[model samples]
Target: MDLQTFMKDRKKLVEDALFSYMNAVKAPEVLLESMNYSLKAGGKRLRPLLVLATLKSFGKSEELGMPVACAVEMIHTYSLVHDDLPSMDDDDFRRGKPTNHKVFGEAMAILAGDALLTHSFEVMEDLLNYDVKPIKVVTLMKELAKAAGPTGMVGGQVADMEGEGAQLSLQDLEYIHRNKTGKLLGYSIVAGAILGDATEEQISKLEQFADHLGLAFQIRDDILDIEGDAAKIGKPVGSDTLNEKVTYPSLLTMNGAKEKLEYHIKEAKRILEEIPLESDLLGQLCDLIAKRDH
Candidate 1:
């Protein structure tokens, strides 16, 4: 398949699925609108695409993974809504539009994020309709919780907040990136494998691949903040610098960060090859992570 066309098509599927889920939920009018605002904000839809692509790599049908894919995107979008709050990244813009708080006010934005986060679990339950095994549903829910909960993304967010303006060690930086950014991504990849009933060996390899891919993804984001076109990126360059946050580029010099990104990308691809599945789609995703402009 043409990788770009494949990605675009899957992205559209995720977007449509997300919109439908949000629309079906009954909520206060403004709250629903606020949630939809950020949910509708255009992104690369990378997380959900990872779910679909990983499932495809194992010869599993996308239909079985669609709910999981859309649910992850909900969780991800909620994170972004909170991440852009005045108390958090405090950014004025996201995806080229005003941040949720800017458009919806801080309280509404917080509620919107809360609604989305909780609603994701509800969406995940939709898998039951497809004759998915209860055990698999439980596993998927557990994976989602572990990836987004205190020991996962929230812990990393806290570490990141505390590390601002402090001189963070390379180890400390990786800790932040691995949990803050990497865990959910790792979950996305592994969840697909689980849904596909991939062998233990294949799941193990994908986990390693995800770990490398997650780090590479964050490092690339840091690089883009320093050197990417602001218009294309949909946010000003140097936001991390402006916030005094320690990032890959901040801890490692530009060249050092680039080298690290390259290493992770290479490692991720190597792990995929070791899995020895039909991995062209997944390999292309690795390349996209390494080289995405936005």
Candidate 2:
């Protein structure tokens, strides 16, 4: 199981579960179509992959974590759907296709995103059907809510919107991304650790690992905005500059940003080394995030 093969296998598994879960939802044809449209739109299923990968690292069955993995992905997709609306980032494309609002209209797109967000909890509750302990499921539900809610992604989004056209410090930029992007990513790993029955100490270390990994992920994204190919990234390059948002490269030059990315990758992998588990895949994932074109 090499890293690429492992990722391909897990991505397929997550995709199958996503469609299966979406098919089970009973809604108006238009709304359901809108929801499934974005849900099926192609992207690296990184958040869900993290869940399954963490479970595997702890010697747990990936099947047991499948529902949680899918649920997190749903939340992630919902956020993207909303993020593309006219009131938000106002992007016309995602994953190399017209965004949800573009294809479905703004009203339906909003409803579709709402459906995914609420439905994610229902999907997460399905973990009990796999005989996951009620307590663990309940705990995960709480954590997921916090991660996706105001204190997490939503809070980060609001801060980002407010910071637009304004000069932002690196600390402020970190605050925005740490909550906006990092919280959900951190949740992906933490969910697996909980279900995999990690010790408190190990969970703490993994959280630290997730923190560094999340920052590295965002920094690379900023780098890609300037240097990456639009075709591979699935969006126009220089969106950050076009939107007038401050980025790592803007705050600390391109070279400085790359150095910062390297620092976080080293720290993330260092934290992984201290955790007693089969974490080679996670280390590879860190490298992938650093070098990913999309």
Candidate 3:
């Protein structure tokens, strides 16, 4: 199938399922509103889409991966919620609307973030229960915990906030992005690999692809900060520059960052090519990000 059609058909269902699960939480009403606000906010849904796409390519039913996909999105949304807080990026706007902390108080926003983070693990654990064996669920838990913990996404966040305006080195940028963004993206694919029962080699290949994919996403985000429209991006276009943040575009020229994005995209596709679990439509998905105007 063509990649656009494939993605269009699947993204809808993945998002629908994700939102429905969040809706069904039926937790305390106000807390649920805070959690659902950011969860339902507009995004490309790239993380969950990756989870579903990887699982699809590996012959797993999308339903089998739906819980994990929802979990990935929840973790992703949780990050965005915290990232916009006063103690963090301190942005008031996200996805063209007020951020969580802007709508709810900082404390409520913090609680919402905590709730989303904790609930994501619950969703993942439930997904693993669908697997054939106890060992499979245990393995899934291991992968999710590692990706979400201090060793991965959370570690990257701490470094990024603390390192801001510190004149970081190139290695520092890589370290932060690799963990903060890349690790969770890596777990999306790894989660798919485990659920789909991919071979060890395929899992490794997908993990590598995910790392490159995550870097590309971050680099493009940097580029967007430089060249993107404020209205489309839903925040100040020059905020990165305003913050004097160290980014690929700030360190190198815009053209140089573009080159790096292409390099990683090619690297990702090359890794995908070597894997027996090729999606045939993966290139379009990569290109979707690489060429996205918004």
Best by TM-score: 2
Best by lDDT: 2
Worst window of 10 by summed lDDT in candidate 1: 270-279
> 1-294, model 1: which lDDT tens digit per residue?
666888888888888888988889988999999999998896888889889888888888887888988888888999999999988888898888899999989999999999889999999999999888999999999989999989899899999889889999999999998989899999999999998889889999999999999999999999999999999898889988887888888778999999999999999998888886765898888888888998
Q: What is the lDDT of candidate 1?
A: 0.90
User: What's model 2's TM-score?
Assistant: 0.98
Stretches of model 1 off by over 4 angstroms after superposition: none
Candidate closer to the true structure by lDDT (higher is better), 2 or 3: 2
Q: 1 or 3: which has the higher lDDT? A: 1
Could you tally the backbone clashes for each prediction?
A: 0, 0, 0
User: Candidate 1: deviation at residue 213, Å?
Assistant: 0.3
Task: For candidate 3, list the clashing residue pairs, or say none.
Answer: none
Model 2, 258: alpha-carbon shift in Å? 0.6
Model 3: per-residue Cα lDDT over 1-294, one tens digit each: 576777678778877887777876868889999998998895877777777777778877868888778888888898899989997888888877899999989999999999998888777666645655768877777887789889999999999988887988878999999999999888987887778889888888888888888899899999998898877777778888888889999887899999999999999999888987646655566787787767
Find the number of clashing residue pairs for candidate 3. Answer: 0
Alpha-carbon TM-score of each model against the true structure: 0.97, 0.98, 0.94
lDDT of 2 by residue, 66-150 (tens): 8999999999999999999999988898887899999999999999999999999999999999999899999999999999999
